[model samples]
Target chain A: MKVGILGPRGTYSEIAARTEFGEEIEPVTYPLITDVAEAVEDGEVSVGVVPVESLREGSVGETLDALAWLDVKVKSEIVVEVDHKLLGTKDSKLNDIKQVLSHPQALAQCRKFLRKNLPDAELISVTSTAKAAKQVSKLRKKYMAAIGSSGLADLYDLKVLQENVQSGQENETRFLCLSKEDSEPTGDDKTSVVFYTEEDRPGILYEILQEFATRNINLTKIESRPSKKALGDYLFFIDFEGHHEEEPIKEALEEINEKVATLKNVGSYPKRF
Target chain B: MKVGILGPRGTYSEIAARTEFGEEIEPVTYPLITDVAEAVEDGEVSVGVVPVESLREGSVGETLDALAWLDVKVKSEIVVEVDHKLLGTKDSKLNDIKQVLSHPQALAQCRKFLRKNLPDAELISVTSTAKAAKQVSKLRKKYMAAIGSSGLADLYDLKVLQENVQSGQENETRFLCLSKEDSEPTGDDKTSVVFYTEEDRPGILYEILQEFATRNINLTKIESRPSKKALGDYLFFIDFEGHHEEEPIKEALEEINEKVATLKNVGSYPKRF
Candidate 1:
């Protein structure tokens, strides 16, 4: 099957795709989620891997809204540890390199590296980590380099001049596998959905949530993004620890849906550790 | 007054600081919000300036917790428009350059630029825009540059090779001015507070809101972040368009407080635009 991970060239998405589909699988690259989603919709690709945190950045809403517009199904999920690496061409040696190029996240994650090692150097953020690595390789500029991932450095034939560059040691990113087809249940599974509260009145959400509570089903995560219809009104993205076909969770959600104004099941798939 | 903004030198924070305090103000540069908060708490700086979106990134909770722990007060606010710029050392010559660095937000905001111009180059991330500019200067290498604010580029002796790198035309950031000494209210004001529900029951929050609604006070924002103590329990961060000192706001809050398990006034400050 043709699979895709976000890439202009080297990104965590590339790392994730390889981890999930095996290194030998040919991976289609896209610069944006829309393009990836479109590839899946157009039958150009069977699946598109996307980052869960991309939603946290507000762009996820655009992607989701685009998906609703595109009518594509979210079929699976994959999670990867986000490890930032500093890559430089043969010329941008550590001895003289002054500017570090990377995606903003790579830069943020590796703040400690910048502070301690290149305290006086400039940090230039690029579009993606892989893009940074590709640039370093192509330019071969001295006193300049990119901070990306080990995979990118390998892809671009650059060197891992530095690694573990982010501020938090426990950095992992979750990605969703998108397909036109739904997944068969994996016993240990997760169901992700987007739901809207029934009304502006208080306790309405509690009523909807009580459905899950009464069934003793566990909810793993919940996040709210503004609906734009009203300032405080929101669209909730919820994930719970169970398959949609399962006993209690399936029953609880049936009840929960009745109470909510809207509930769209994004997908159900094996939960990645 | 000594003001603090994001810096070693050059950044939107530096521009924000200068705009609010002018060139005469002594500005202490901080790499992170917690550090700026620390500077304010220790009396090393009179006021701390921070980007609001950075708060959304999870630092606000820590900074607020720091203030709650340190008892530093929010005195005033100064909102600034964060304009991303494509900057390079004058000699780096745009199209020839292969690496670009920037803060993550700058990079994200300017995705379209990277996709169109440096589609093949690696995009690196950095902790801050100023740091990116500084690194480029220090690297003194060829084909490397950064995207930052105009002010930051100047601070590092870089040139604005391209302007308006942000994807959004109206993209602007709001910065908060915080201090330990509380200021008397300026007429236009807003109140921010943290509150917890008495129970995980429905209508409990609606009951609290009835008081505000009755008083005709509009709530600007109400966000829930995990209390981190329990699975379902959450702490609510609320902002409303009124001064706590106002009679209606005082009476309404007094009534609402009687119903909650806990409540804390984060602050009431002039709603500076």
Candidate 2:
């Protein structure tokens, strides 16, 4: 099966795809997360892998919104521990580097290291960390470096000047596997769904939550994003610990659909640690 | 009284500050949102103004986390209509410009305009739009331009190349007035708070929502941010209608504080349209 990922190659998304589908799969690469999702929906690829959440950035809005608007199901999930390293040309020294380039989030994650060690270095935000490594390889500047993964070093033929440079050592990103096909129920599974409140009334959300609580199903995550219709209006994205095929979960969803303006099942898949 | 804002001036934050404190108020400029919050907490300014939310970007995580970490209260909220314009040096021609420099958010907002007009222009992300204007003015490069507000044109003595360049015509940002002092109860007011669930129970959040629902208070917004403790652990930031000083609201908050692991009242302020 052909899998799609955000890449020029060596991006975290590509790493996640390889982790899930094996390193020899040779997944097709897309420039943007939205493009990967589009490829899956259009059948250009059987599955698409994209980052959905991170410890520092919270949820990825584009991925969430794409799932909501398109007819796709989250077939599975994969979690990767992110380690951003400072990469440069073979001859470049860390202390002599004058500038660092990477995606904004990567730059933010390694903020402390850059500020302390390369206090005089300028930070230039690029499209992605992989692109940063690619640029550094092309420029071959004596005083420039990039923050990315060791995988990036191999792909772009760069050297890892420093390892694990991020301020938070515990940073991890959750990636979702999107496909047109749904997954069969596993004993331990998760159902992801989005719902909008039935009306602008008090206690409406309580009514929705009561559906899960009474069934004894635990909620894994819940977030509300603006509906964009107005300031106070919101659409809720929720994840709970259950398969849709389960009797209690089925009953809970039936009750929830009745109380909500709209409900879309993103997918049900085996939960990942 | 002095107000703090994210600046070298001509930023949207400055516009919000002027809207709230009048054009005559002398505002102090900080390079980062965290610095503005710090200025307020340190009593360097009477109050600090910072962007908290926007139609495009749901919430400013830095501001939200800063408010949670600092001992400050949100005094009020100011909504500003964002209108991005393309500005250039006096001798710079629109067709000759090879680069457009601005904040990342501003560049994203003007994606359509940049793609259609200056398709070949290299997009450079700067710290702030005002700083972009400052750079263009100082460099006096005919092939360089900046995306900013019309106010930036006046401040930097640059020419307006184009106006209203954002993709969405109705783009607006919500700025919060932060201070050490809390606000008084107004007839039409809103309360903001953050709380952690007592434990990973099936319906603990439902019970918390019931507290406000039973009191007939409506929730304006609800978002879950990673608590940084673990993967599923979240700190819920919620905004609801009615002032905390109101009898029903006060009683509801008291009840909630008892059931949750922890509860913090951000503040009560008049709701803006």
lDDT of each: 0.68, 0.85
Identify the runs in model 2 with alpha carbons over 4 angstroms from their true place.
A1-9, A25-33, A92-94, A97-99, A114-127, A131-143, A230-232, B1-4, B7-9, B24-32, B44-46, B86-148, B153-162, B168-170, B230-232
lDDT of prediction 2 = 0.85
Q: Pick the candidate with the highest lDDT.
A: 2
- For residue A60, model 1's alpha carbon misses the true position, in angstroms, by 5.1
Candidate 1 residue B198 Cα shift, in angstroms, is 19
Best by DockQ: 2
Question: Residue B141 of model 1: what lDDT?
Answer: 66
- By DockQ thresholds, what CAPRI class is model 2? acceptable
Clashing pairs in 2: none
